[model samples]
Target chain A: MSKHLKHLLTYVVALLLFVFMGYPFLYMISTSFKSLESFFIEPFAILSWPLNFSNYTEVFTMGLGRYFMNSIIISVTAVTLVVLVAALASYPISRLKFKMNRPLFLLFIAGMMLPIHATLIPIFVLTQNLGIYDSLLALLGPYIAFALPISIFILTQFMQEVPKELEEAAMIDGCGHIRIFWNIMVPMTIPAISTIVIYNFIHIWTEFIFALVLISSPGNMTLPLGLQRFYDEFSVNVPALMAALTLASMPILLVYIFAQEKVVKGLAGGAVKG
Target chain B: MQTVSPVKTSKHLEIKKKKKKWKHTFTICMFIAPALFIYGLYVLYPILSTFQLSLSSWDGNPAGPTFIGLDNYIRLLSDPIFFKALRNNILVVLTSVFIQIPLGLILALLLFAPLKGLRVFSTVYFMPFLMSTVAIGLLWIFIFDPINGPLNKFIQTLGMKPVAWLGSPDTAMFSVLLVIVWQFAPFYMILFKAAMVGIPDELYESASIDGATGVKKFIYITLPLLIPTMVTSSILAIVGSLKQFDLFYIMTGGGPSNATELMGTYMYKNAFLSFNMGYASTIAFTMFLIAFIVTVIIQVLEYYRRKKGVFS
Candidate 1:
């Protein structure tokens, strides 16, 4: 009887913790669609309010459109490059019987330990020197670098998993290295690549430090920078802020709704090992 | 008679082998070129320059920078603010391992049970990780706002005085810690739950055969197997806490006399607010140092624990 009671108690605790963990998100959604009068009054009214879409309208009109556009451009461009580079680089490093391969692998892994905070001032100075300090390209350079180690690590592990026998068979058929890589290896790693793209997209989309310090002008602000503007002022309408936040999270949420499985597959393995 | 000709041809084949070595070198270069060129030009070069800047002194203003060797490093060593920042980072590390991770583990264990609607509960728990940290900070700021905030309201409802959460110096660091842990524990919970699922069923089955209690089985079987994963998770938690920027930067801005300042926040304050490029580089190096040290220590600890048969 006590064993059954204990099982019952654990489930109750799980439900309560789930609610506690998710309250802010629920509250944000609630507050975003809420009438101004009902903002503070509807504390935990999970089932009470009708949806209001005005805040989203306010978000698009009030300069967040550009930020949203910029986020897309930066994340897409960066993630694509990170994947392409990681694939090519990781392929040879994992496959080729070269003398310096292990050390080279170690080099990128060590680079993983280098903190973004450490690279901040130097990257800013370098960007400034290159005359692109306030440009989108400047943000991509450091983000790509910072993302390389993990991308390469993940990609290398994935590339190594491809059957050597397939490559051997292709080699015996007079196929060249590039042909085998394109036709045989690339297809197998697509899931890993997709996971990389999604993970890196979310990571780069939300990255604020490089964006904040590197790009000063309003014309170049990313979502984190734009969200920060609301934070700077004394009286940003809480509902409007929530509205903008909800909009900012759309890409991540939409992707997650479909791709949470792949994400768990990707990170759970990497997380356990490293 | 043909044997003589075959031996002569075999000697000539050695020349072909020499040329094949060069061809292999070319193929290797072709494969690695674009990756190296891009990474070298952008990522590798920036890190090198940052390390160089850490050794010099210059404010990052339009006049460019003047070189004063080791001043930033000297200043960092003697600076009270840097020490305070380091202390706060350590607190984040401690709270993660001691409070957050353990709580996450227990929560995950509960959530991993064969209860009804566990899937729905799992999704709900992981919701915070998918949300924006900036939005989270803003929400919590209001939640802990001394006036008309939920925290104070709850206290008032209980017939108690309100505590200044984000306002007071003494409470501020703990307050920030609380907010971060709340936002992040769900993440650890889901990750830990996934790890728990990988533990083999036979371990539990065997333990049950030996008449082991559930708690005893967990301590003996589950925790040992999960140690390596927990270590890696803890490292991520430690580093994430160390490099935490958006939440602390927006919520507190390391104010109330630098009470809530972390390494990442302090680096920003130095680099941007003061335009002290050299000092910021030094602080950045300081972070790199701490991360490197912590990572090394974790590796060593893992080694020793394994050597001592602690996990086995």
Candidate 2:
């Protein structure tokens, strides 16, 4: 094939794959705007013009708004708690000389291999015993715990590479370990911290099994659980369901778009290194 | 008097040093305490307790569990559904390792070439990985919906009968796998692409100069250089496949006579749906053991390969 023809072929192939990959998302967005009649009548059409906005409104009226707020609260709290705890714990393991540092770090690292299902029953029991069952508080502990391994791993690796000279200089000025950690270490590891925040946010936002198992109250249900419930309850309402899915996914999708580079790099870094 | 004073000074200095050491240890503990506490309470405790629970019969109630020794394990070994779930999980692992990774690698290679608008294509391809798996599951569910779904509509247009993609036992597993691949192949693609980008351009240039172009150059240079990444991604894919719960759970609920029941969903059903906590724990423990074993095998293989200087 001629070079130009070959390039055109590549473009054609790329476009085909792009459509194959992206059509679902596009179909979702288009369908959300579509009326039920249009959806049923012309299912494969990319878009039915004269967009119906009622699906978006209907989703809000159908308790999606409550689920959205619940998700935001849980995800934000979990991310904050995980980032703070992981950063604090990672600093000592990464920088200080402690006898149990390696073992402690390994302990957290081993948590990565732990499948959440293995711990589900015990956690469910523990939450009930602790009187946090059927509440949002029940999720916080597990979310932070599950997020620790990767957060600590990434933070510690990043922290270890932080120039020791800065810490030494701080010490020369009579700064204590805590002060140095707060001032020098935290600011320097912002990239890693942001990565942790983004990751934990997305994770806790979408986490379902735990949410489903733990929180039984309809009022306390997170987005995924809420969406699942909505799907079950309104099995036939494709347009409204699509709208809810779109709404549920929008926040994280926006976050990913805004911080695409950091998200990608962070994920890539964590995966490759870990 | 001078000798006595000198001994007193030494004792004073020793006490000060001891206090300083104590202070340092206290600071270290303070830094580590919060994470350790949460991790211990939530992660470590549950893991140990799950093992304990696996050995006993319980209804997930406040009442204590009854010790049943190895009965749960024996039951799991004999259970047909457990075996079915296990089969599904193994199939997922195989498909992920054999299919997803290779497909991802091929896509990565395609994008690695200096194609125009590659960035746009890359972003579009990776968009699915950014969305929640639940959302992806719902999206696929819509796509496979028997009546108004796009897939069936397309089939009808092609002059064929519309299949109930997720409703049939025969096609359910395949449908679930298709969604899995669609959702995750881009992730592996990005990983492989990152690894490929790191390969020195001069290697490709050198190969092309030797009249080895396209397939030959890729086979000799790109493929070999990407092995480390392939190995890592394959391990990731396999482990991920083994533990997959959300997509299948949300999509099929391991349904149509449990044709798509994975180990994760099976354990979940036993614990939550049936309230067979003991049996569920046994399944969970077994899942953990398999994950651990798979990881160890991969690590051992990686070790041998590294020892042989297969990786740079």
Candidate 3:
């Protein structure tokens, strides 16, 4: 094929793949605005005129808003805890000379491969025994633990690349390890830290199995769990379920759009390295 | 005016050194303690306990588990459903390795050559990976809906009979696998793309000069250079497929007569539905063992390859 033809072919192929990949999302957005009757009648239509806003409204009335809030809280808390703890743990392992640093780092790395299923029963029993069962707090411990491995792995690698001269200069000025870490290290590792924060936030936001097993009460259900329950209760209400799915996915999608570079680079970095 | 004795000065130096050493250890401990505590409690401890749980029977009650001593494993060997689930998991792994990774590599290769509007295409391809699995599962469930779903509608437009994609046992696993590939292929694409971008342009330029261009150049240059990435990514795909839960669970619930049962969903049902904690733990442990063994084999293979200077 001619060069121009090949380029055109590539674009055509890419566009076809794009359409294949994007169709569901576009269909989803359109369906959320569609009425149940229209959805049944014209399911394959790209658009439905006289869009129904009632599905969106009905989702909130059916307690999607509560689930949304619950997700936000749990995700935010988990991300914050993971980032903070991971950063703290990573600093000494990355910079300071210590006897057990390598072993400790490896310990965290080992945690990465742990199947969440293996820990599910024990975590369930532990949370119940600790009296945090059926509460949002029950999720925090596991989320932070699972989040630690990758966060620590990434942060430690990032922190190691940080110039040691800065820390040495801070030490010369009588700054302690904690002060130096807070001032020099944290600011310098912001990229990695933000990546950790975003990944953890996204992971915890959509995490379901733990939430399903741990939280019994509907009052504390996160978006994924709540959506599952909602689907079960209203299995036939396609439009409403679409609306809820869209709602559940909207924030992260928006974040991905705006912070596309950071999210992609960060995730690729973590995945490749970890 | 301030001439001190040698012993006094040496004593003062010793005290300062001791204090600094203690302070250094304290700082290290303080920095690491919180993470260690939480990780130990939630991750490490639970992992060890899972092994114990696997060897015993329990109903998840307060009465505590009783030692059954390998009964769960023995029973699992006899269980048909467990074998079915294992087959499904292996099928997922095989499909991911043979199908998803290669497709992802093709897409990545297509997009690798600098082209206009590729960024937008890349984002579109990757959007599914970022979306929640539950949402993806629900979306596919709607798409596969026999009566009102677009997939069936499209089939009907193609002059074919509309089929119940997820509702039928024969097609259910395939449908779920399709969704899995849809959501995850982009991940491997990004991974391969990253590795491909790192290949210096001069190599390709030289290859073309030698009249080894196009697929020939790719086979000789790009494919060999991408081996390490391929190894890592394939391992990722394998482990991920084995541990997959959310998509299958939400979409099919291993349903239509256990046609889509995976180790994950099987273990989940055994634990939560059947309340057979012991057997559930065995399944979970088996999952861990499989993942662990696969990972170790990959690492060992990578080690040997590196030793042979295969991709250095």
Q: Which candidate tops DockQ?
A: 2
| lDDT by residue (tens digit), candidate 2, A144-215 | 999999899999999999999999999999999899989999999998898788777777888988998999
Candidate 1: where are CA atoms >4 Å away? A40-51, B1-15, B303-312
Model 1, A161: alpha-carbon shift in Å?
A: 2.0
Question: Is 2 or 3 the stronger prediction by DockQ?
Answer: 2
**lDDT (tens digit, per residue) of candidate 3 on B118-176:** 77888888898888999999999989988888888888989999998999999999999
List model 3 lDDT by residue over A120-197, tens digit each.
999999998999999999999999999999899999999999998999999999999999999999999998988887
Candidate 3: regions farther than 4 A off:
B1-18, B113-116
The Cα error of candidate 2 at residue A248, in Å, is: 1.4
> Where does model 1 sit among the CAPRI classes?
medium
Question: Sorted by lDDT, highest first, which candidate order results?
Answer: 3, 2, 1
**lDDT string, candidate 1, A110-182, tens digits:** 6666677877776777788889988888888777877778888888888888899999999999988788879
Model 1 clash pairs? none
In the order shown, the chain A TM-scores of the predictions are 0.92, 0.96, 0.96
Q: How does model 2 score by TM-score?
A: 0.96
